[model samples]
Target: MAVLTLVLLLAGLVLGALTAGAAPDKQAIVGSALGLEGKLGAAIAKAPAGAGAGQIDSSAPRGFLGIPGAPQVNPILAFLWAVWVGWIFSTVGAFGGIMAGVGHMTIFGLGDYAKSFKKTAPELNKVLTDCIRMANQWLVGLSSAISSLNYLRSKRLAWPLGLALGAGSLFGAVVIPIMTGGKISFSQYQGWFGVAVFVVGGFLLYETTPKGQAGKKAAKAAAQAFEKSVKEGGESAQGIAVKKWGLTRIEFSFFGVEFGFNPFWAFIGGVLIAAISSFLGVGGGFLYVPYLTSIVGLPMFVVAGTSALAVLLSMVTSIASYLNFAGAAVDWALIGVELVGIFIGSMVGPRTQKYIPDIWLKRLFVVLALYVGLGYFSKGFFGQSWVPM
Candidate 1:
């Protein structure tokens, strides 16, 4: 797996470099962008005319999409951040997209850059937000694919449930871009993104408490058994087995512990998750993790893989819709570097996860989510920091 990851990363780097070519010269890029004024005008017809007059400064250094004075991301930092993004998602089966969003919007300074255009060039700000959202999905999409393949090979993935969720998510993913793409501004996007994560973080924190774990007896038993098997070096032989499959309920077992979920409700849950995820430009794994644990009573070992499968399917529709229908563009050069890192990080996660306790995994991300959520939410919504961040 490590060798395969390295090979994929190298190949991706070469392909992305060849396809993206060198960065365009500022004058040429500015000229080309202005040449499309007629089309750009029509695209932003929803915005008032002359709103962004004199906003274009050809003398400024080019950034993403040839925007003047926009912050240029360092490739090394982007790669490192993506590696972290892949690791978290693959390890815990959640927060990969939110972390990716944080990198694009905050770590790279793109969020502030886009927010600068909210009033002068509301259309531009919205477009940049869409691009950020789409870029986030790209990282999640690749990580989820790799993670899903790894989990599936180990027999930890729930194919029926993942596929059902994927199918249901297709509807929401497709509809969201058409309805809200090119419509959300950076501030609004950031504010809402923070809110979603913050709320989930609080819920997950409660889940780690004794009271919350009270109802999860089966999950706890399975987790303990899986942990014991891992320590004994015999877990690879133990995998999920389907006990019963019916129209109403799907039953499965791991380590002799049983779990079941309603297929119909799972589909509905998928729809709602995808709608919110697509709008937020995330993989929806954060939500999926809670659902798998709280509602379905699955152990972490199974939840990660199942979440990865669902994310893989949902990201495909979400990315295509944003690009084709929403007119969003991504920096392939940057994404290429990030993809290589993501592949490497994803390969490491599954191998190392067995050593950590299930509760610890959830706890680690919950802390991060709450901190980031509070910072972004308060700043984005109120123009002031509620936390010291």
Candidate 2:
């Protein structure tokens, strides 16, 4: 099953790389649709009607035969560029897509593609965002799948929580992002996204403080339970087993620890998580995993699996909605490459996670959350990155 999953992800990577880069410039597509094909018209006039082929096509092949074309990037380069994306996803269970987006807008900027949009700043920003969302969805979705499988096999997944969260996330990931008549510009998207990240970061930081030592204690206890269970039943027995599940309540046992949670509350939280993640082009791990561990009081191990499942579901919903409604174009070449790395890393991260203590995960979360949250807040509100351009 593991090998098969890896194979499937690799196949998808190749296919996405082959076609995603073939997407036409966003401005050209919209312009042609709106009957603003003056350039194409002029070019057509300049060509002789004999053997010379002067044409204008939106869905033309851009990256066939190892040639990188407009919007279509080289798969090899994309793969190299996306290593960090996969590594990050595997580690924390989210934000891989958002990180990719940030990369695309800066050092690894899509200069050639954005330059084509000479219409206006908003138009160019729109294309940039569309690329980010498209890449984010595909890259993170595959990453979540790999991680979720590993977690599920370990028996740590909170099925009831995952389902409840998925239910609300379906709408939040789909309906909310495309509600407006037109696309949201980068500034507007970033502003709202920044606020969301900032709040989540603040909460997580609080959890790391002395007052939030309850979470720390809980982590220590869970780790001890994991160790005890492993000794008693072997590694196979050191996982979560559902005791009960219902509309309002959820019950499960991890190793030797019993855990109960409010499904309805998880559903509510899922809605919020999905909304922010979908709009901001993230998998909601940075937020979801922390929420489960710190607020929902689930163990760090359990949170990883539960959040991974929820993130996959939400990404699926977000991808479908954006493509179907917003007509958002995907940077398949970039995402496909990222997916490959993500799949491999995700598979490894979960399997090797048994050795790590819970405190380390939470500490990692707190630091990353504070940094990313503040950075995003600055970018969104001030129209600049936390450090600089």
Candidate 3:
């Protein structure tokens, strides 16, 4: 029954994608017939064909902003990209959604296409932006679910802390879509996204320095123990045990190293992070990573799993709000194929992460955050990207 259901779902995704591609303008016509104005339908009617002034093509491709020959995405590239996204997020417990955004906006040319409609059809541009945000959450949402379960199996996840954070995130996640959805332009979104990633990258980079490392004795000790367990091939040395749980504090031990955090502060952090993430259309793993390591003082070994749990909770609410209240739409074919890849990559990340050093995991995050942040920020605000896609 499970296999049959899965097969049916896949079939539906394929059919949906095919239908959208075959008759791209059908949805627009229906919207017009139903008296639903503004957004994509209006964009199609208003957008210029680029051939001459006032030229319009009602049958424009979805992401091309009425340019008939704008490049179609290569499904293979998208699938491969999604695989990478899943792995990174599952392994590091952050940045999966940001990377997914990069692929959707930059690699697939959707960003340029969406931005093109900003002046001609501001409503349409915002709608496309919302879709991009919605799509990013979808990939992250699935990756987070898989990563959480895998980490739980290994006893690396901090369930109590995650639950507290998730509780706070629920409120923020639901509120952001209602406030910002259908209002933000693609370029504005990109600029802010870049700024956020860049700022987090800087903070994390500082954490890697000797001065920053001075205070993180617990994290280093926990990391060493985890690495030793990996080398010795013993389950005895690997697992997280709850030491105490209270309204004010939550404590856990990993490989005999104790870590604790204030549950109240964690909940507050969750609310703020979820608001930022939902607005930016990300999983908030990047933010959670820093919070766990610096504020919560957990070692990298446990941070990934814990971050995944919070992300899963926040993403669920954010995606639901976008689809239900914001009127966002997604390309089922693209999302469907990418989801398959995300699952494969997510499954492999936890198993492979045990082999990598804790410090290296953080270093990886820094590199990606810096690079992605700089490129997107410059492109969005300056009208030209400093880095090549």
The C-alpha lDDT values of all candidates are 0.76, 0.61, 0.76
Q: What is candidate 3's TM-score against the reference?
A: 0.67
1-389 per-residue lDDT for model 3 (tens digits): 99999999999999989987795442222123122233445444444444322233434453332234344778898889988877876786556667788898888988887787777567767887888887877776655555566765666778888888888788789888898888888988999989978876777787787777875877788989988888545456657889998989888888888888888888888899999989887767767887889788888878878887788788888888887777776677888888887877888898888999767877888998888898899988887888875
- Candidate with the greatest lDDT versus the true structure: 1
Give the poorly placed runs of model 2, Cα more than 4 Å off.
1-77, 87-98, 111-128, 154-157, 180-182, 192-247, 250-258, 299-305, 340-380, 383-387
Displacement of the residue 156 alpha carbon in candidate 3, Å = 7.9
Q: Please give the ranking of all candidate structures by lDDT, highest first, separated by commas.
A: 1, 3, 2
Q: How should the candidates be ordered by TM-score, best one leading? A: 1, 3, 2
Q: Worst lDDT window (10 residues) for model 3?
A: 26-35
- Candidate 3: regions farther than 4 A off: 1-56, 60-71, 83-97, 152-163, 203-263, 298-309, 340-371, 386-389
**Candidate 2's residue-wise lDDT over 175-211, tens digit each?**
7667731266555655565575556556656666787
TM-score of every prediction relative to native: 0.69, 0.60, 0.67
The CA root-mean-square deviation of candidate 1, after full C-alpha superposition on the true structure, stands at 17.5
lDDT tens digits by residue: candidate 1, 114-147: 8876875677788878889888877775555565
Better of 1 and 2 by lDDT: 1
Backbone clash total for model 2 is 2
Pairs in steric clash, model 1: none
